[model samples]
Target chain A: MNSLDELTHELFTFFNGFSSWENSVIKTSELSVSEAHAIEILGTHGQMKMKTLAGHLGVTTGTTTVTVDRLEKKDYARRESVKEDRRIHLITLTQKGQQAFAEHHQYHSNLTEQILSVLSNEENEQLINLLKKINAEAF
Target chain B: MNSLDELTHELFTFFNGFSSWENSVIKTSELSVSEAHAIEILGTHGQMKMKTLAGHLGVTTGTTTVTVDRLEKKDYARRESVKEDRRIHLITLTQKGQQAFAEHHQYHSNLTEQILSVLSNEENEQLINLLKKINAEAF
Candidate 1:
């Protein structure tokens, strides 16, 4: 493979490894990938309405509705009405959902630590800098 | 945040960016995420049996069966009985499936190029080296 192909291969290999780790972590829990993602967003950003959640998830409100329905059925999240507008509902994670999100976050921390263990201090700094630039510009 | 937390945040931010890009790329295609994943695996690894494909996807054989069913119905892939083992069948991508995989690969290359554009040559090398170590040992 050429340089570009080599970079692409390694990039994807890393992404796939992370993806599998994430999927397996979610599999061990009672949440599907989408549900876990919703919980993570709700846990981190506090609470939001359906439209905001949909925007964060890059999915349609219709699809978000189905995911929220499952989350509600499982008691991991709830949609509550505001006093001012009964029609507007904000999605909130239940205690169980919070626990799940915390566990997911812990898993992320552990994975980051694992990744750090394999790199020198200087390499870790490089990685952080590189990711910050890519995250800001590449996407 | 501490150093560990900083690394954790940056790591996940990068992972999420890659995930969103991947999902959007798959969205623009005529395949669902799982279907596109199956096609990519089949196209990249050549024809394989259901069990192998399931192993690669980190999903169950039953789930693989459903995915393959959709692929077959969509005429993107097919299962063929091998001469050596009549009971065992290998999943093969159709021409349409190959085209989708090629498109997906092109998207990956495009993303890689975009990511590369934001970094200096040395930073790119640092990323490749860091990713190599992380991919080899982190997961």
Candidate 2:
């Protein structure tokens, strides 16, 4: 049996490596880390309410509001009020935001390819299966 | 063969789940995200200078200085001058900080156990070996 300590160390080491790679990738762009995260969520899931964005980002609505505000100011995103309920606002990425999202996603694909290159075909399938189980149930 | 796009989605979904779990865990504490990150590094690696901390965090020194300042204020860490090089200062975790590290690490172990329960013994070993390879080469 692999000790919990060994697995935990390796898990965190992997997380840290991914994090550092992400931070450096964001640094080369104009978007802040939080801003880039918001963009990713919005891009992946399409337009969503502020509350939903906050939930996805695991941040407070107030924090999401600030991030959305910055994105709007930078012309990367916009908040539109629903005609039926003016109080409810849905956030959408603008053309600029979509472009950034595509660029960022390409980088993610590149990284994924890099990771795939290091593993065997069977290992890649095993990894996907393992990650699927963990993602669906663990968290 | 798993397509790159499919693997990319699963990988990011897994990453997002882990990220959300971590943020929520941190939210229950007094430490900010950046501060908690710094403590994790200092606690794991022991004392280090400001530049080294920033490098590990993949952030700018200015940003690190601000984070270290907050840590110092909270008495979670301190900067000590080396006698041989008065200009150099190493950041060390205080007793309180060590206690916090232990607590946070326990949360991580709990999470790992939770994840382990969802997989078989063979799967667990496979996971460790796969993570080892990825951590060694993927990032």
Candidate 3:
């Protein structure tokens, strides 16, 4: 295979392995992977408007609405009208949501440590830079 | 933030971007991402038993069965009873499935090209090696 082909194939395998592990971790929760991701984003960034949250998640407002509905029903999150603009709704994680987000973050930390252990400190830095470059310029 | 924390955060964003792009590409099809993935695996590896396919996809036999059933209905794949063992089913892509697989591979190729365009040849090689190391040793 060509260099590009080889790289792509290896990347695909790596992602597959990582995602399988993620699925197992998220299976422990009542939330789907996407739902848990919404919680994580809200927890990290604090309360935000529905549009902003949807933008970060790269999902449609409709899909985000459904997700927020489920979170609200589970008491993990709730939407409140913006004080200045009652027409706008902001979504915030509840205490339970914060707890779930913390657990998920810990799971990621453990996985990160395990993966980073395979590389030297320098290699980890290089990987981070490469990922940033890809994210910034590749899309 | 610490190196580990920064690395984890970047990786999460990278994956989220990639998956959103993948979802958009797969949304044009009748198949879900998992179902399309099953087609891709079968297309790449040629015909294989259902159990083997399930193992490769890191999904349960029941889940694999549902995906394969959808593929068959869509005329993207077929399950053939092994002549040696009537109870055993092997899954293979049909002609249309092969076409869809080719399209999906091309899509990945385009995305890979865009991502790799940001890196030098040497960096690409290093990245491939790093990914391989992670896959091998990161569990």
lDDT of 1 by residue, B39-67 (tens): 98998899999999999988899999999
Q: How well is candidate 1 docked (DockQ)?
A: 0.87
lDDT agreement of model 2 with the native: 0.92
Name every residue pair that clashes in candidate 1: none
**TM accuracy, model 1:** 0.93
Candidates 1 and 3: which is better by DockQ? 1
RMSD of 2: 2.0
Candidate of highest lDDT = 2
DockQ of all candidates, in order?
0.87, 0.83, 0.77
Which segments of candidate 1 are over 4 A away from where they belong? none
Quote the lDDT for B100 in model 2.
92
**Candidate 2 TM-score versus the reference:** 0.93
| Interface RMSD in angstroms for candidate 2 | 0.8
State the lDDT at A55 in candidate 3.
92
Show pairs that collide, candidate 2. none
Q: How many angstroms is residue B115 displaced in model 3 relative to the true structure, after the best TM-score fit?
A: 1.3
Q: What TM-scores do the predictions have?
A: 0.93, 0.93, 0.92
**Better by DockQ, candidate 2 or 1:** 1
